[model samples]
Target chain A: MTFPESNLRRKKLGQALMFGLARAISYGIVAILLLILFFIVKQGIGVVNWRFLTAMPENGMTQGGIFPAIVGTLYLVAGSMLFAFPVGVMAGIYVNEYAKEGPVKRFVKMMTNNLAGVPSIIFGLFGMALFVNELNFGASILAGSLTLGLLALPIVIRTTEEALKSVDDTFRQASYALGGSKLYTVRKVVLPIALPNILTGLILAVGRVSGETAPILFTVAAYFLPKLPGSVFDQCMALPYHLYVISTSGTQIEASRPMAYGTAFVLVVIVLIVNILATLLRNYFGKKVKMN
Target chain B: MRLRRFTEPVFESLIKISGYSTGFIVLLIVIFLFKEGISFFNLSPVDEGSSLWVHNSNPVKKLTAPQIKDIFDQKITNWKALGGNDQPISLCTLDELGEAFTEEQLGAKFERLPACIDSYIDSLPGTIGFFPDKQTANALKNAQPVQVDKVSFSKFISGTEWFPTSRPAASMGVMPLLLGTLLVSFFAILFALPLGLAAAVYLAEIADERVRRILKPVIELLAGIPSVVYGFFGLVVIVPLVQSTFNLPVGETALAGSIVLAIMALPTIITVSEDALRTTPRAMKEASLALGASQWQTIRKVVVPYAASGITAAAILGIGRAIGETMAALMVTGNSAIMPRSLLQPVRTIPATIAAELGEAPFGGLHFKALFALGCILFIITLIINFLVERVSAKRVR
Candidate 1:
């Protein structure tokens, strides 16, 4: 009995060491990442001002405020979401609700998976050639938005499908048993139950497109537009592109530093808001999924 | 037809086509890249002066408006065009802008030049060489372009920076940009993988629900944040920190870029790895406990081993993101076109080079296709990584 207890003590010590190492690794990762973000804010926050953001790019940099970029990003996120939401959802509904086990379903699923794996740069090239070059849009906001729409469509479809599939199958059967048409059951019974999850997925995808840079790079080539976007044809500014310019030697390199951070802060806020909202929704639905 | 109608066409083609539109774009990008970039890799000699041995367009035979501007600025052709200031548009030199610099282009030196362009620009009063977009704005005032052969000085308007066109037909050297891009991305993966893996393990196995809820989205937020923001963050924070730490004259190095990129890639690895660890059945841990094995020992020996393949796939995808990333790398990197020395040394990357220069490349020229070829290279890398990930993940699933 004494032998076993001592052995247990020694074993316990070793386990503690291993757990310490694993915990160290985890803490180290988070600390490093946050340190980096804090460093950005520390070095650049002082320079952010309304005037700096409102100015135009002068002497090869963003001289004015990034109002245009803010608007451009808004348009990009809104436009892509508007386009991706309906089509992706419809496809997901068809796959889960209508299509049974079949080749068509399999092929669609495979394509969706493949889309997630494909690099974002290819999307940039395609957007550049097809939207800007072929379509003669010439690096405008609309072209960028459309390209982003196409890029995010796959994510929207997959996430929405997953959300829809998570709903209890019994709920669907009950709807059908209660003399409900398949279409009506899907539209009313299944959708109401799955709404929170679908919304969470939508918010998550929207957050993604808002922050994406590669696809937008080739599609929207304007360095800094002085005027507000009255049309999609007019070029626009974006925070991501602004960061690119400032680092490359636009103007008052010191001054531009804060603008970059300010934009980062803004982006973080947007994402944080989305995350909080989505997490609440997911939690609400997750409880329901568990209960059933 | 009647029988087909009655059966409801089990292989219904319309149903098959539904939502396959996503596949359509992916296919088009891959095929289009191949088509445009194939010639860059071909490097074969044809009968019409289109190979390495012969000049495709007589690169040395003559100069264009831009070449004129570059060579002339350096005063290479002092006698050909006289009395031009060092600044191309200066009144004393050419008097186009103001009275500051003269237009008399005489007695320019070609020896001991800063780079190829500095002296080349001096060679001819009207000669020019290319500078990237970063240098272009100031370059315009100091250098003026001239028409050469079929290409006009107005060529800048019709063109973008892919200059594959060489007089007498010659091969273009875009390798530096491509190499630079690959190098930064490669280093980024190296720095990010371990940290991200650690986070994943911690989150999946060690953390409480409160910590999980707080930390998960923070990692995920890194994914949602724009790369440009990372780039900006790099410029202001990492660059200065590196500079001071290493006592380097400037801080914008590949290492700085890697740090920012590593941070950018953390969420991807952490998320994937967490999922991998979460899938480890609780029964295994309980069994290890019953057998008197320690919790950590069980996790290391059994849990991690089971998740190894998944972790590797996650790492590859993270690397793919690193390699293909454009704006952040373009921003934080010094954009200097040199083979990287240490992580601390400044270097240009392929994606950054393209983003920096492609806008100004003369359209349909050699430089343009070279950027496309660079894209092709990036695509292949991601493609291989993706395929490997699929194989590994599928096997693990099985």
Candidate 2:
């Protein structure tokens, strides 16, 4: 009886030890994240003032603000969304609602996955080859937007498919019962329900596009442009690429360290805010879908 | 009604066309990569409009790019070593030829430069001269052009050096960059797997509902942080820490890259593996408990085994991301294009190489094509990884 009790106690102790180890690991991962955020914010907060947000860089980018990069990023994001949104959503609709479960659907899904997996640098090369060279777009906003739009396509498509899948089939059936055509039913019933979730995906894509540096490296990002881009055909400065330049390749790497930190802080803030917004939107609509 | 009838088919076709565009775009990427990359093999390793000339009596009539580089760099100094008569190898370039003759001796337009080059080669049995092909074409009387093989596939793959800007010939050996990429990714996965697995288990099984709710989104946010920021963090924090702790000259080593990549890969591994663990049937766990097993034992023996495919997928996806990761590796890996010997050494990855060099490589030039070829290699690597993930996850579904 004593031996059996000891054995049981040993098992219980082992269980507690393993559980505690796992919990510690989980917390440790979270701690690392918090540390990164804290370190950046602490180091960068001094440089992220009003002038930093609104003025053009000065003194070889060792001083002043990142306003043009911010505006350029906004332009790239909007332009990419303009291209990727409709195509990705329509592709998702066709795949989920119309295309039969067959090789064609499977092939498209595989392609999307492969596209997502294709490193951003490859996209840069392809963009350089096709858009920049073959299409004669030069290293302008047009080429960068197209490249980034392609990068975001798979994300948008996957999210739209998931959102559309979540809408109840009875909603579609009800629309059909009222003599609505397939397109009408989808427009009236399916899209209205899936719009918020789809928007969540679009917002996340925007975050991704704004943060991406590699795709824009050759396609559009300029080292420095004295004046803002006057049109879509012109090259422009971007936030992520600017951060990379000032931190790694600038003439005043040490002198501009403060600016690097400040840029990183703003970029992180933008991405994190977008992520939080996406999460909130997802949760709110997720609850609504369940309640309905 | 007629207008609606006409528009319906048009709308349907538009949707169908959009659906097809994804695959079409992927196809276009492959086409474009090959279109630029395949031509690299057809070009000579030597600079355009330049050729290497050797004495007529020298037995080594042909040389590969690496052999020529080695001979010029004095790594191979004996003619006998290169299948020639016993003699010391001598290298002559345009500047060296200029040193041999004055402007008055060569002529005002340097029209006598080619004759001067030929006679210089004639003076030394082991001499190899590098000059423009146009200059040496009909001018060399006693010297013969060494037949340089075009860039071969085997040489490109196995050659260890990566000097794309070397004179006379650009050394486009991809081995060092390939090894560096694999080395960093291997170490990253090594660091990430255990931590990611443990965190995944906690999120899937041990964590309370409230903790899971907060932790999950936080992890997603971790993934959302731009890779460039990670690179910056690695440069500022990890690089210095590595340098001081190890007492090294530089902190931007493969070790720094691995650490950053590991951190970046963790979220993907945790999220995927947690989802897999959650899918372990509740009934299966109950059955194990009914059989007098502890919760930990049930998890270890039953839940983990059930989710093994998913965990494998997670690991592969993480590795794929690590391999393809560019900006961070570029920023922190020190960007040295040498064969990496240890984690402490700075290394250059394929993506980083392309990112750094593509700007300087002239359009439609050999260097540009070589970078495109690197892109092709990256494309294939990720392609294989994606295929493997599909296989693993598909097995779970079945």
Candidate 3:
């Protein structure tokens, strides 16, 4: 073969090999994911019955169900959302709408980034010291929720900012031309357009709150609470905490294996559902924006 | 319009307060961690016991922290090492201090007290007693109260053992834990970087649009999975797999933790590097290809070089995730606080140590403070990583 021809063939072979390797590596992710999902489902499905979902645990947590854990997780998610949503939304608006280019804005942005990077366990420690001990909230859902709220706060702000930014400036200009005040334009025009994306953030937050074990572990997770929590002040069992307990610390580790799997499966499903909802909302809103 | 006039200032202030609250929260967390953690340096575990007591005849006036540890660990088998009479040392339990009280004073409620106390200081000339602080006033009449030397800040940081709950001499050294965290994370990076880079390259430069579209969400779902679930999988799957494969008695080795962490770090590494690779200029890529370079050559020589800073940022973020991960590591990495030399050996990371023990550590105790110190270390490490990522990504912008 001539020099150029040989070089072309060699180049084609190299590209083919690289492309084939890349494609194989990409599929490897799918395979590993499927393996995890399949393993969890196969082990957990046997114990994921109605009793497992709705009844309180019994027999040193080797029998019965994880009802209180489910309730506690829901309560934590709700409490965190209550604290996080408005604050996060407002912060997003301030960054994207009110603040232009200032040191304060820059500081806030930097703090948000740092806050996102702060380890979740650090958040737990902080919560235990501040909310649980100093403030005398004790180990309760309120403290756990507040810690988790802080954790989810950065995600909320980022998502809300992105959502609000994606709204056309023309919409704000139009509202202003119609004599709308800044607050009026934001409340009536910008937020409405940003609602779907904001919901996406909130959904993502739900997914985050449900899955978090570290932040809640010290702040609220009760090792064995058979009854549902009566108030925010009451310590409660949570699904993630329950799974941690059964798998590692339970009295009857061998007996509780199925229960542990069931709890994990439930927690995974809750997070997955929230994530799927958020993804779908994001895509739909994205498509709508593109079409517009 | 009429309502807006009244609400505008109120709304604006609210927005400002909420916006700046992130700064407030960060300040509060840092302050709280430092306030709680720093106190451990001067904390005396002797405060927990009724009072510190040595034989009235012993020459040793006070014992330092290491001396106390040595006595408890039985390393100082004789009193001469502690500047006392050259005699065999006897470790006394809290129950042994009850002999100081009378039968009527200990009646019913204190019935078992005298015998308990007798067994503690029984015939042993070099007995060291750690009584509860509640018994301090009563115990001084019978036995001398020796002041517990404060655990110096340096020992806490540099010491190797981490038995925070060890009685009489709770070793709160974080060296093993710090080492374990670094070792596990280093292995995690070793495992994750190549796979993540390969996958990122595929998603960015190799895969068709259709494949990219499908794989992206699948990766997101993996990222979205709750870490506790990952922990469960590690416990049941990786831990046993490691055990059987390595033929170790227990599965919860550092290797199991590293594997789990590698998987956890993959999404961050892949996503960040892919984003970086996508930002490589199309002009540069085309120029490389037009110069008779293969697609592989173009990607390697042009795209990767262009995205180097971004890839570095990705690797930093990935390492950050791996180091900070708590649950999975806690579950799978045997919570043994020993200086680890092998991947098969059980090791404890800083975050896992905190997660496993923090709940039981009393609020104002040395253990609690030590855990907080670990948090401070973790926080600083992550902050440095974040700063590096920021600097690297900032260069990408330029």
Candidate 4:
């Protein structure tokens, strides 16, 4: 072959090799993800029984169930949502709908992004300082919820803004033309359209909050609280923290390995379910929006 | 109509308040961090209600906390080493004084303990005693109090030891933990960036639409996995793998931590860089192709350059996550608070140190404040990363 022809042939071979390498790497990532899931399920499935879900841990968390921890996590999820949802949605609305294009809007957006990037452990520190010490909540559920709420706030606000922005501008303008007020236009027209996407965001936030261990490490998270917490003022055992303690720091770490796997399985299942739900909700609503 | 008007205005005002509070909350975080963290430097490193006393003839009048730690740790064994008299230093604590005297002679309520401690210190020429202030209030005839220097920011940042609960003084040096954090995060980015960028290239350019649809949500789910679970997986899987593979005594090395963090960071890097690559205008690629460049050549020469800033932002954000990551690092990185010399050795990151140690540090105490200082350090590091991300991605927008 001529030199030029051979060079073109070599370039074609290089392109083919690069494309193949890219495809391999992409598939390799997917395979690793699948392997993680498979490993967790295989190790943990045997330990997770009906009783394990219902009964409290026994024998220093090496035996019995993680009922109290599951309940505690549920309470936290509820409490955090109560604090974050309304405020985040409102802030998102104010930025996306009411606020004009200006530095103020830019500042709020910037702060939200910065807030989203702050480490979870820093949130834990601030929560401990503000809620547990300054506010004298004393490492209770209330303190943890507020901390997780703060941690989840940016996610909620960003999603709410995106959801609200997706609603057509024509909807708002038409509502105003029919003699509706700004608040009424948002409430009656934009919100209805945006609600599903916003719900998806909230679900994703739930997934994020429920799996958080750092923010709750100091704010709350008792190592082994077999019984349920009496009230919001009481510290509670959470799934993520429970798994961490049993696996790493418990008295019989070697013996409690199965229980650690069990707890990890439960936490992963909750987060994955929440994530899958959010994805389904987003896809369903996304299609609906397109249809309209 | 009046009711609607009242409610509308009330709701609007409420949202407006919430909107403004986002910025306010970020400010509050900084303020509270400084409020708690800055106080660490103001406090003495010596334990409260305790004092260190050396022989009256000793030339060393004052020593820093770290020096005291070194003396106690026996890393500094001779008094001459610390600019004092040439004698072998002996360490004494309040409990050791109790060992020298009987309970009957010391009195039931330890009322006679003070005199016994004073006499004990007087007998030993090379002894440095750490005891309660109340014990030596009226009885320091032979022993002189060694004034401990206050904790300084320079010492705290540059000091190597991290024995926070060590007696005579707590070494709140951040260098080891900081180095460990930087080392693990650096390796994580080193491992993650290339693979993530490659996968992103596949998803953005080479993948068919159906494959992209399947992979996108999977990657999102991967991102949604909690750090704790990742830690557990690392503990059960990667730790042992590393241990056995390298023929090491234990597996929870910095390498294991880096592997876990790299996996955890992959989805974020891939997703962000994919978006950046997708933003490379189609016309740019077409022009390159029309110039007789192959698809791979066009991507490398055109798409990658166009999206370089976005890729940098992704790498920085990944670094931020790896640095700030707590539980995974805590579980798998051996929690050994030492300077990491190699990836094969166990190391602890700042976040892991805080998470593991904060539970035990008494609230409002020096150890607690030191952990908070570590938190402040972590916060500043992440903030800089975020600022860089904003700058890089903002350049992309322009």
Candidate 5:
């Protein structure tokens, strides 16, 4: 063999290049993220005060705060959870616990996956056609929330099934040994153990519905409103829709830039909070799982 | 025991209802979309405004499709272009024609309709007033019906212009929109695939445990970031960046949209590919390392090859996200419904077109159905991709 020293030197160079390449790639992601966060924060930090959060918008939506948008998003999140949580959790439990391993379960899973893959804009159309036009909901929060609730349903079912499956088999067996009915055992024993994980799923669903813009654009999002909505029938402004309007189609693009950035920052913060909560819950549940 | 027996069937039926309702909604959405959109494909003049005909006193009784398009598009501004006497053409919309008739007067037979039509045509010698076929045949007099062609399916597919509100006719071609969608999504996948794959490699085979723990959540957070936020970022940063870099008039271009979508696609690609890399059999990597291969060599030669299908799945999923993305593309792409020639040119995507125009399109109108048709196309494309992803992963399992 020719000169081991040269071969070793070439190998060292190869290793350095590869490791450096890997490090650079990781750093690239971090840098892109940091740039997005910092840029929005720097541009919008001036507008994120108490008045901005609390007051209603003014002047062709060029000035003032997005208070109704905040309340509207909260209302949407609550409405979607009300519809999606119970149905999704029940379906999840049925598929995981009651239904036997066979074609029916597989079909349900496949359908859920397919539904999840459908573009949100298609949901917007469907929502408009079904809820706004056919059902005569007439472009209100009720229609938008139902559409978004459908969007979130697949995620909830998937997560709930996963959470229920993570519960130990021994607990169920003991319940059965104590003459507990299948339904009784599942209601008290299985659900209690799966509750935290289910909550995690609901939190994630909240994050999803609150930020969605396309489905609500046609069904629910109002162009501008000076006052807060009194009922679900009324159309209301939302943060994502408000951000979209000001940034793209605002009458005065330059003047509205500050508000656009602020809206983005608020949206990012909301999503991040929900994500952090879900992550913390997941980790805590995971650790408890390992301990048990 | 009696209570348990009574409650068991109730719980069972309730759970069954919930489980089936999920599938039912998917069915309902598909049916509703198809029901509303299928009229666009009909050969008959079933679509409203499709039966509009031009009535004029000029010698020209017949016109070709291109001639009609040119006249409404303002290319044929003068009457001499169609072999008529040298005079300017006066175009009147259906609303003006309908405005002449009172509601009670139009209930049965023509009262003042013939006079209204004669006066309208007589006022301007080279006049072209458009009215529906029913109104022209039965309700009007002294005005000749100009031979008009239906807006055929072929014309809709291949026609370059998309003037849906053009007077005397509405051009409903979707070629530019389809092309723009393809262009932006293609560029997005081009930019995102490499970076996402590289990041996945680092996380899967190179990063330490501590780094993995921290970066994993960060990547998930990236995915959790809303599409609207990404659209905002594109508007504020990438739009200006592209404008300055390329020396273009405006920052909103196909290039700007692609850049934003590429960033959005990263988390999906990275997560899927990392999972694929992690699933590579440990023995394959150990064997490669034992055979005098370096850690990077093992990763490149053995791990990646083993996980090739997964990486493909990731790429397809990323493409799906790019195509389906509406809000970000709408914000950044200049919303011009023209055929895209360059990445720097402003273009409109299908989803963007729908979101932007659907609000103004009257219910059950031709323009309304056309947007739904665009939605149908988007649905079919994403459905195919989902099937491919499912098939690929299913094959991997086998």
Candidate 6:
């Protein structure tokens, strides 16, 4: 089809308009989201003073500084990574290296996608019924860890799978030609290449769990937590839940509402810091491998 | 040969195991939700002596087992039996917005109510129906709420306080709570959907690749944000903005909830619809322009039509986000279970109902079961919409 002279100008204008809609909407959304983050960080970071974090929330303003929550969130993140990463990464390896386009492999892919979409509150309910109450752990850190672990499993799998998908086939071919087994090639070559991407995914997942309040609301996170968690079985406070209480149900310290912002600011900083650290590690290792 | 015999079988079997296990775990979540959620349908004889149902305990220690039974059974149908000579006791239920109604007001069907047969027996105590044990549920029994002299039970159901667990006759029901959830979600959807759609429509129809990349990630990060932080922003900023703007008595009105939910759902709508528009074929835009259509005209017509199904999916997804969101809604919505019709009024939604109260609810208790039942309802609705969205979006060639 031949285009008329008028058509070209009109089409270009139409394209710009179309593109502008996306541009404007995206910019607006970004601006608001940034505002949200900026607000939280501005209000919250001041309260996350080193002493406040190290010590408990005092004089009602503190909301019991998120020291225990930081530790609890860390513990939960570590525990979840420990629980899910190996299984998720291994599953990715199996899916990429071994499983052909068979029904079993297909089913695994479907499961991974569905797992990603299940709203986390459902996870909370399931955890409450099965892990916390049924497993008789009560509202302990262990239950929270396991539930959060399950939440992250889908992320780990999907990201690791994508990373593996991007790996070149020549590496596998060379490894096999050298009489290396599939396992040896994957362990040595495929995994190392995909490590950065996989780690990035894991970090993102941890960031998500660290900030979530719903799953642990019923599974863990007690309000009015008098003493700190001495063990894994005891219920502990979390920054997210603490923020919820301070904002929603706080009968005390209505004036110290900024503490919630302080908590959020710290949360965002922690996420950004982890992301930066992960990026550095990835970059450092990436450079090292290239040099080698 | 030895390696083949052991390694081949062992390694292959292990791969098979993990692949199958992941599928099983996903299935396990669905199965778990359906199983617990479905258990609510197995209604048994509340009339007692029926072996089909197990005898559950009355969780409220303030009332004895018999009292709990009498109250739920509504054997005492009027206030006169409880030392007041007036007012009829009605079977009441708090809707998600904590809107309550007695049988007389609701007017309608079910298994025969117990106290109704006794004919408003004056000797019998006034009893309220519906499960009330969890902190969010209303105190129908021994709920000594402000005694209104109204002849009907609907007036009492509309009152403010909603303590499900309280001393005799002094009680609080979640009328304000139900209202709070609805008001918040309503306001949230009001703010979120239009703004989200406008942005999504814009991004999908017009943005350059470089701008799209930066903007898309920023929006996605909005999705990645933990909601507790949103709650903080709402409490600190949005609350003040609303109070100052409206000059209303309370800052934590439905308007705050709308603002928060609107922000949260923005990314989903934009991402989905933008992807939809992006995938619209270059050929279509070319054809539209050949007709001398303005770029704006071409977009308003051809490009948008191409992405219509995707836009619908985005809207549904936004709606899902709005409906299912709990923490932000709960935190900002003032948690008052009152009946509110206006967007400015405080209201609560079903998800908030479960989140705000499920913690204190004992397993197998009436309140617990009711919340679980609500979960089931939410799951079914969301799952159906999700399924439809997935189906249509998948067919979208982009």
Against the unseen true structure, what C-alpha lDDT does each candidate score?
0.67, 0.93, 0.87, 0.92, 0.85, 0.66
Clashing pairs in 5: none
What does candidate 3's lDDT look like per residue over A152-224, in tens digits?
9999999999999989999999999998889889999999899999999999988988999999998999988
Fnat of every candidate, listed in order: 0.53, 0.77, 0.82, 0.84, 0.69, 0.48
lDDT of 6 by residue, A1-292 (tens): 7788897787777667656665565566788888877877766677767776776666664444667667767777787788788777777777777788989787787677666666677778877877886789988888988888888888888888888887888889999999877777887888888788888878878888888888888877877565688888888888788777766665664765666667777777876766566567667876765565
Candidate 5 A-chain TM-score: 0.95
**lDDT, candidate 1, at B348:** 80
Using TM-score as the measure, the top candidate is 2
Residue B315 of candidate 6: its Cα lDDT? 78
Q: What lDDT score goes with residue A152 in model 2?
A: 96
Candidate 1: misplaced stretches above 4 Å? A1-10, A36-64, A99-104, A178-182, A284-292, B1-18, B39-182
- List candidate 4 segments past 4 Å from native: A1-3, B99-118
Task: Compose the digit string of candidate 5's lDDT tens values, residues A1-292.
Answer: 4558888689879988988887798879867976887787788888899988998887777788989999989888888889999999999988888888889888888788888999999999999999999999999989989999999999999999999998999999999999988889999899988988999999999998999999999999997887888999999889999999988885688888888888988998898899989988988987886777
Residue B348 error, candidate 5, Å: 0.8
Worst 10 residues of 2 chain B by lDDT: B130-139
**Of 3 and 5, which scores higher on lDDT?**
3
Using TM-score as the yardstick, the better of models 5 and 6 is: 5
Q: Model 4, DockQ value?
A: 0.85
Off by more than 4 A, model 2: A1-3, A289-292
DockQ of 6: 0.43
Interface RMSD, candidates in the order listed: 3.0, 0.7, 0.9, 0.8, 1.2, 3.1
Q: In angstroms, give how far residue B253 of model 1 lies from its true place.
A: 2.2
* Cα lDDT for residue B242, candidate 6: 88
Assess the local accuracy of residue A72 in candidate 1 as a C-alpha lDDT between 0 and 100.
82
Clash count list over all predictions: 81, 0, 8, 0, 0, 50
Please write out the lDDT profile of model 3 over residues B80-126, one tens digit for every residue.
88777888987776444444555565566655554445444546658
- CAPRI quality of model 1: acceptable
**After TM-score superposition, what is the CA distance of residue A189 in candidate 5 from its true location, in Å?**
1.8
CAPRI-style grade of the A/B interface in model 3: high
- Tens-place lDDT per residue, model 2, A85-118, is 9999999999899899999899989998999899
Candidate 3 Cα outliers beyond 4 Å, as residue runs: A1-11, B47-66, B80-86, B92-148
